[model samples]
Target: MSTHPLIGWAVVHPWPAAGIAAATLAVLGAALWVTVRTARAIAWPPGPVLVAGTGALVCTGFGADTSWRFARDGLGMTDTTERAVLFAAGEIALFACAVMARANKTATSTDDAAGTTGVPGILVWAITGALVVPCYATSGIVGGTIRAFFGPVCAALLWHLAMGLEIRVARPEALSTGLPAVVGRELRERLLSRFGLANRDRTAEQITRDRAVDRAVHLAAVLELHPDGALSGYRRRRLAAAVARSGAGTNGEQRHRLLQQLAARRTSGQLATVPLASPWAGTPVPDEAYPRTPLGVTGAQLRTMDPLAAVRLVRAAHPEDSPAEVAALCTGYGVPVSETQVRIALRAGNQVAAAPAAPRPVLASEPEPVLGAGLRLDVESTALVHPEVQSRVPVLAAAGTRTRQVHARVPADDQTEPQHTAVPDAAHPVPAVPEYAVPHNEDIPESDRDVPDPDPLIEQARTEYGTAVPSYRALKTRYGIGQARAQRIRDALGGTT
Candidate 1:
């Protein structure tokens, strides 16, 4: 049996063989370090590492074996030492190419960082490995060795060039000359189908119609929830783009028509309408539902009023009004009271019968007919005036004239004749009536107040529970409060638990 060229060389040149082995181990360690570092830098998976490592090993082993075999066969050179030297050189060149590729990839900009290379490590190695036998067979020792060294370098460059060309050619859209109309249409349909926007079984006309209907429905929903005025220009453009991408019209005429239809349906009472103050702020209220009325209160003032208080005030003014009508009345007053809140107030009112009607106070006759028209006091005013008015009324009275007597007819059981009290008017001022004398529903329990202060309860909860408070249910149980109040307390506590 003939001794292997490497084994025979090792026997004669033991020191050189040892140095070569050391260099091989050093190259392997370097390759491993580079692979791991590059993989981490680019966030690559272990698959690329395994693939590159296997490629490096296969290329080195195969190229060296092929070089030895070709030289022994006297295809280019019969010198064993030259064959061995060329084999080692080829192995080193292949590894150098791999390291260079990885280093170049790592040095790329952050925007181009990749988890995988454009040309895979395995294919590059295989091409370079296969080139080894041909280079040595075609040329003598000196020329062959040079070719072997440069073959892997050239292979790496060619691989990158091939990848770039493939990418550019693969994009049909990048071609300067357009494709045939039919081919372009087919490509568009294929792309749409891949993205689930088109169906193979459906005709293009049917697809376009379906997409238009979908866009119409989406626009209708958006308008139904948010008025066109509420949508920003960017948001409107985005929505328009979305609609246009679906093959729908871009002018928003369809959206306007949809809004008209939705408004008509809500006006006809076919669809439930939301309050204009809340989720539907900028939406126009239907004329039939919210008739314009001079309610003397602005939307800003109404919004400031407690929702329950607004409901009660509107209900008192229109006792015969339904919950919807009461809500409409408040809406007319510039308040956005939902029908649901009116309904709740009405239900609570039913449980508690209406309070006894107070006697109408007779206004003292003015000496010279006080300037400005007659003061119009809303029916609920005698019961519950807003604090803003309450404070302002006293200040106005203090600035006006002297005291005037106002007679109020009392019940026969209490007094046969009418009772007299000093009252304030525009021309004649008297000491402001005591706040307690106001005929409000004082008989109602303290707990039944429309709005309660949440601060004290929130503070107490924090003191008791520390940083991590229990759920609202636990708070409700401990505080003996309603679910809403407990929730408010928990929310105020930052919802720790």
Candidate 2:
């Protein structure tokens, strides 16, 4: 009775067979350990792990057998030692390929999929086929050749599965949002580049202070654009607190200084545009010339007058005053005046009187403009009042109250006859009230009654919700109003949802 070919060969070459068996056992043990360890670490799914393991075992067994036969017969190597050596080398090479694939997968885990350049699966298959076909053709063993062809292909697929499992565990954020990886490796690198040194040197308190300062800088910009009523009370307080934490002085002086610094940095090139002949274009003036005191003109008059005219008038009366002083005076008067404006006026060489002109007398029929604290309100046209200022002044507050009263008195179903228009004479002059001002009921037409006032609702919402006001639809549902009315309320409240 003849033994199997494999058993007969092993008996003939005991040492080589033993060495081959030992190497095979060692490689399989190492592979098993690595697979188990990696699976546990990345929480790999059971199905993929089982499939990969099965494929790896099948491929390794087939590959070792084919490598041994190919070395002995196809390569014409009669020596058993050489054949065993070739077989072991082939197994090592396959293991090395799998290890390389694992490393490559780990390395590129954080790289954006869109940015990465990977070896195409077709190209890998093609290369594997190119190498296997020639060896299979030379060996002339159909079953052995088929095993050789599929062995490396299955091993490649196993490597791919391992890599996929690693990515699934390590970079789930990339897949979850259908976006490139952002959370772990890339974010760590960016944060290290930006804050590593500072974090190392600074204490927790110091780091916190730096963050507060950064927040204050951002809030300062918001306050500049939307001060007072434009911001909800909560937002205003939060912004003010942030500014104060950054050491902005009392009454926002430091905040204003920061604004000036920012403005200067933004417009640093503006000085180049000034003519050489201008007084401000030359050397800096003495500090004494730029007094902080009020200018000769009142705040109302300063705001009403042109910037250049105001500058010229101030300059003529106080020739000693510098452009900075004039600007300070205008600013104090609630009229923001830049030094550039004063310089431009001085450069123009316009003639001016030694004193400002006297106020013109107002006719009884003509309404006197009401000057509020830091605001000018024209009775003839309520539109001129700034929305922020309108929120503060009592006169406009009264208008809102009167509007509500008028709405309440007029019955929704009543259809009164249209009254004839009357021209005002000496006895019945035009009333001091604005033509379209809502709260008063005297001359308002019936047609205009339905036009809703959004101010009251806006104020009510602000009082209720602070900065987190509801959407227009929510407001419509809450207030039992139409979409248009709700939209008007939203618009009045600075268009915030």
Q: Per-candidate TM vs. native?
A: 0.22, 0.25
Model 2: CA > 4 A from native? 1-47, 111-127, 138-145, 169-497
- Whose lDDT is greatest here? 2
Give lDDT for model 2.
Answer: 0.59
- Compared with the true structure, all predictions reach lDDT values of 0.57, 0.59
**Per-residue accuracy of model 1 over 200-261 as CA lDDT, tens digit each:** 78777656655554555566556656765666555567656655564445436555654565
lDDT of candidate 2 over 2-31, digit per residue (tens): 899999999999999999999999999999
Model 1 local distance difference test score: 0.57
